[model samples]
Structures are given as C-alpha cells and as structure tokens.
Target: METAEKPNHIGRKIGRIRELRGMKQETLAEELGISQQAISKIEQSEKIEEEKLEKIAKVLGVTKEGIENFSDEAIFNIIGNTVTNHDNSSLLCFQPNFNPIEKLVQVYEENKKLYERLLKVEQEKIAYLEKLMKEK
Candidate 1:
C-alpha cells in the first residue's frame, strides 16, 4: 500500500510571504476585492483554493512554489554565510565613488523644494479661507 504524505500549511505560507513583503491583510483584500475578514479566514486555513492561491501569489509577487518552500531560517542562514565565511573576514566592502558633500547638497536641495511646495500649499489654503471670510 502506498502512503500519502501530509500536506503543508499553504495558507500559512501565503500569509508569511504576504507579511514579509510588508503587505497587510486589508491591502491584500483590496487587491483581491475581498473583505479583510475573508483574508483573515484564508490565512487561518491550512488549504486554499487553487484559483485564489494564484491570485494571492500574484499580489504577493511570488510563485506558489516559492511560498511552499519559503523558510526564514534558510534565509538567515544564507545571509549569515554570505556575511561571514570560514575565516570570518567580511565578504563585502563599501567603497563609494561619489563625493559625500555632493550627495548631501543634493538631498538638501530636494528637501528645500519639498518645503517650498508645502509652504505654497499652505498659502493657497490660507488664501481660500480668507476669501471665504470676505464672502461671508
């Protein structure tokens, strides 16, 4: 007699992948056009319908097989190995070819532009309120 293998918790895998991607149940529900409660129920389930699973996989930007084989421990192990070899020397080095002062100036300019835009928006709101008061 052939023995049947136990199935994995596919729903839990999907939920984990969704969480790793920084997606909320509400966001997944909105993308799937379902309710948040429905999403909660799905995540709590051990199995999901194939069509629904496909939809969820697409939204989470992963293949069904990827979710099935996802392991946090494996990811951390890979990162640890990459960071520390047998000798414990660093595998990666940081060398920036660009000038730090130039980058800082660029960031400062971007922030200034954003602040100016916000100030303009506040000024517009004030002008609108003043106009409304004059009308009254």
Candidate 2:
C-alpha cells in the first residue's frame, strides 16, 4: 500500500498563527533573526531543520510540540480564542478575509474616481472665476 502524504502542518499552522497575531513574515523573520526569504520558504511548506523549527516556535511564542502537531482545527480554535480575549475594537478593522492586493486595487479605483470628480469641479471653478473677472 502507498503511504499517505503527510500534511503541511507547519506552514499552515504558522500562517494561521501569524495572521491571528497581525504579524507579517518580515516582522517574524526580524524577530527570529532570519531572512524574510527563509520565512517565505517556511510558509510555503519547504522542509525546515529542527533548529530552525525551534527558533520559529520561540519567536511565535508557541511550543515546539505545538508547531509540530497543530491541525487546522486546532489552529482555528487558537485564533478564535485570541479574538475572544481582545476588545471588539478590531471587529471593523479586521479585513482578515480579504486579499491584500485586491483591497489595494479597490482603494486605487476609489481614489481615481474621486480625482476625476475633483478635476471636473476645479475646472468649473476656474470657468466661474474667469467669467467673474471678465464681468468686473
């Protein structure tokens, strides 16, 4: 019989916990004294040595066992507990479900529309000023 493929628990759990703590990969990398590229590799489920795993667990404030064994359900429970302990202030601030790049595009489109409208308003103001000057 073929052996079942092991789940990518380390990457998935790390990603879940990091997002729950509102930490970026670069920030975590800096805290652990590792390069962001290394963090990226970890998040992407690349093989990590035992020493690196220990460092990551220390930086994330999780136990080495927790890093090694967390399932998706366990990670979700941890995230839920974290949210419950905090004030509801971030209820509105949390855009955890949205993709960052998509949000950026949305803001850009909104600003572009606002800029076009403002340009039209400015042109009208200039026209009114010219008419007033000619009348004077």
Candidate 3:
C-alpha cells in the first residue's frame, strides 16, 4: 500500500522566502499596509488569497509561481554542487577582474553628484523661505 505525500503549504513557503530575503514581519506589514500581527497570522496559515499572495510576492522580489515552487534543499544542492573543490571541500572564493580602488572611486563620484544635487535643492528651499519671510 502506498501512502500519499502531504501537500506543500503556501504560507510556510512565503515565510521562508521572506526570512531568506532578510525582511521582518513588521517591514512586510508596513509594505502591505497591514499590521505585524496580520503578517504573523498569514505566515501561520496554510493558504492565502491570490491577490494578497501576489502582493506579498512582489514585495519579496519574487513571482507568485516562484514562491509556490521554491525549495531550500534545492538551493543548497545547487550551491553545493557549483562550488565544490577538487578535494570535494566547499570553500568558494571569488576574484573579480576589476580594480577595487577604481570601483570605490566610481561609487564616490556618483555619491558626490547626488550630494551636490541635494545641496542645490536645500539651498533653493532656503532661498524660497527667506523670500517669503522678507515679503511678510
């Protein structure tokens, strides 16, 4: 006699994805415009409404189908197989073919431009406020 396997729980799968993505229940609740307790309840439920599930999936940076089909074991197996050394040890090290200092300088330049734009906006706001004060 064969026994039937239990069906996967959609809520549990969604909870796992949210955990893996480093999101707190409160954060998800804020994004969904619901309470943290509601998020906790949703995580404990076996099934969720399709519309709510789609919203959660979008906030978690995954599709509804992706959430439904996700498996932690499959992810672990893929990473384990992909990073095995000749001795079957799993000490994976990545070396990028670019200068680290150059990348840092590029990022710094971009931040500087943004800061300049923000400063300009603040100055404009201050000028407008001063103009209003003079008129009054």
Candidate 4:
C-alpha cells in the first residue's frame, strides 16, 4: 500500500509546518487575512503559487524553501538523533519537536527581517512628515 504522504505536496507540507509551530487553521487564516475555509483549502491543495507561498512562509516564521522541503521523516530523524534513553543507550522515540536553540536562531533571523521591514516603514513616515513640513 502507498503511504499517506504524497511527494511534493506543498499544501500538506504547509499544514504540517503550521501544526509543528503550534498554530491552528483559524490562527493561520487570521494571520493571512483570509477565511478559515480558505486556509483549509490551501492545506488540501497539491500546489500553491510562489507569491502566496512566500506570504504564508513569512507568517509561519520559515523560509519558503523550508516549507517546500518539509518532511515528517526529517523531523523524526532530528528528534530521534537527539533524544535517547541514556540508561540503556537506546533511542527514546516520541513525537517530533523543535530544538530550542535552533528555534531561537530561527526566531532571531525572523526578528531581524521584521525589524528591517519596520525600519523601512518608519523611514517612509519620516520622509512623509518632512514633505509636509516643507509644504507648510
């Protein structure tokens, strides 16, 4: 029998990544300014446009490439490698979860991008204010 997972199913990958981040469909919908049903449909899709994928990636705190390359096996491997039963020197397998340090670095990178975006907005506001001052 074939496995449930389909290769290069972008929508499924997005849904999994969202779940890994502890997000709900409703929450992701809100972040994307779309209806919850739309989010559901997206998760059911086999392909998504690159622009929409970029927006979703930004909201999910991951790179578009990351989402495109997501896999349950990769996650399991990461967790399986790190979590072990020291007493018996065997693997203590469980649900896949984040590596705190890796998550921190990812968050830091996202924050840096956010900061740059915010800085650009502030600079635009300043420019507008200066234009008003000059017009007065």
Candidate 5:
C-alpha cells in the first residue's frame, strides 16, 4: 500500500505547478477529463489511482516519474535546500506532506480559537486604556 505521505506530496505538486502555470483546478480537471472535485481531491492529497497520477503528470507538463516518486518530506526538503543553495536545477522535485481534510479542519478550529482569544485580550486592553484616559 502506498503511504499517505506520497499522495500528499503529489497533491501539493499539482497545486504548485498549476499555480505556476496559471491553470485553475477546473482547467486541469478539464484537461484530464475528470471532475473538479477529483482535481480538488488530488490537490488535497487524497488517495488517487495510478492512472490518475499519470494523467495529472501529463496535464501538468511533468514526467510520470516526476509525479510517482515524490513524498511530502522530500518536497519539504527540496524547498528548504533550494532556498538555502539557490541551485534549483539540482533539487529533486518532491511531493508535499499528507494533510488530510480532518487535520486541516482541526487546525483551523484551533487557530480560530487562538485568534478569538487574542482579540478579546486586545479589546480588554483598549477598554482599560480608555478608562484610564477618561479618568485623567
């Protein structure tokens, strides 16, 4: 069985390349003759079949091997290494880390709560400052 990491990497690559090429997910889906949802799934790193991978590679103007061998960690390293060395040509293309929908949702919720707390604190501080100014 393929590890979850692999698909995540492929999805991120698809997203990045599509963005770089100025292609929408809908457009990629059309070129691949798949649904927009399917493209979304691929971009989100959902489990996709081998044939779909081939189609994605073709549509994205990348080689099949390019898509097949990528892993999330590998892609992260590629980005990190390339930024440090400025030698993108030698960097092995990588897939992104597996980020499931559930995980994303959870993270979103956590962030939302944190943001809310920050806002409350700011409001409280402003109220205190305003009261002090009024008293003065």
Candidate 6:
C-alpha cells in the first residue's frame, strides 16, 4: 500500500508564519496596501504568484524560501530544545502568554480613536471657515 504525500501549500505557510510573527490579517493587508478580504483570499489559495509571494514575504519579515520551508514541527522542536530547567530537563512552556485577538482589538481601538480625533479637527476647521464666511 502506498500513501500519497500532501502538497506543500505556500499560502498556508504564509498564514502560519504571519500568525507566528504575532501579526493580524488587517496589519498584513495594510502593509501590502491590499484589502483584508484580499489577504483572506490569498490565505485560502493553495498557490500564489512568485512576485506576489515575494512581496508577502517582505511584509512578513521572512524570505520567500523561509516561507516555503516552514514547518510547525521544526518550530516546536526549536522551542523545545532551547528551553530547559536548571536541572537540565527540557521544559515545555510553549504556549503564547498574550492573546492575539486582544492585540488586534487594541489596535482597532487605537485606529478608531485616531479617526475620531481627526474628524473632530475637521469639524472644527469647517466651523471656523463658516464663521469667517459669515463675516464676509
């Protein structure tokens, strides 16, 4: 009996790397000047164009080859090997302490605040312009 090998999906690799880097799709989309939906579509793709892949790699802070060669097992192995107790036993404390969703929400709140501030300034400018025009 022969088992078929699964294809290495470049898009999946890109998504994993981005997640590992603690990045959100919105952030990645903003960096690439693309829509969040576009980023979602790209992640769903099994294959991506080489030039576009290069640009994505740049935004992810990884080389294209690195994305192509990415493996979850390798990351776990590296983390497992690097961490150890004083007695020389390996400690498996691999879970991320911070929540990714929380980070994304914080960013969203910051952007909303900035947008509100800018809108207020624009409204004040318009009011000033209206007052000046009334005097004319």
Every candidate's lDDT: 0.87, 0.83, 0.91, 0.94, 0.79, 0.92
C-alpha lDDT of candidate 5 relative to the true structure: 0.79
Candidate 1 backbone overlaps, count: 0
Candidate 4 residue lDDT tens string, 24-128: 999999999999999999999999999999999999999999999889999999999997755763445543587878889999999999999999999999999
Which 10 consecutive residues of model 2 have the lowest summed lDDT?
82-91
Q: Of the candidates shown, which would achieve the greatest lDDT relative to the real structure? A: 4
The residue pairs in collision within model 1 are: none
Q: TM-scores of the models, in the given order? A: 0.57, 0.49, 0.61, 0.59, 0.43, 0.61
Span of 10 residues, lowest total lDDT, candidate 6: 85-94
Candidate 4 C-alpha error for residue 26, in Å: 0.6
lDDT by residue for model 6 (1-136), tens = 9999778888899889999999999999999999999999999898999999999999999899998889998999999898765663434655678998999999999999999999999999999999999999
lDDT of 5 by residue, 1-136 (tens): 8765323466777677778779998999899888999888888874567887787888888877776565556768988886764766645776557767878999999999999999999999999999999999
Query: Model 2, which residues run further than 4 Å from truth?
Result: 1-6, 75-136
Q: Model 5, stretches more than 4 Å misplaced?
A: 1-8, 68-136
RMSD of each: 10.4, 11.0, 12.0, 18.2, 16.4, 14.4
lDDT, candidate 2, residue 76? Answer: 74
Q: Residues 1-136, candidate 3, lDDT per residue (tens digit)?
A: 9999767788889889999999999999999999999999999888999999999999999999998888888889999898756763433555679998999999999999999999999999999999999999
Q: After superposition, how far is residue 34 of candidate 6 from its true place, in Å?
A: 0.6
Poorly placed runs, candidate 1 (over 4 Å):
1-7, 85-136
lDDT rank order: 4, 6, 3, 1, 2, 5
Name the candidate, 1 or 4, with the larger TM-score value: 4
What is the Å distance of residue 130 in model 1 from its true position?
34
- Model 5 per-residue lDDT at 77: 93
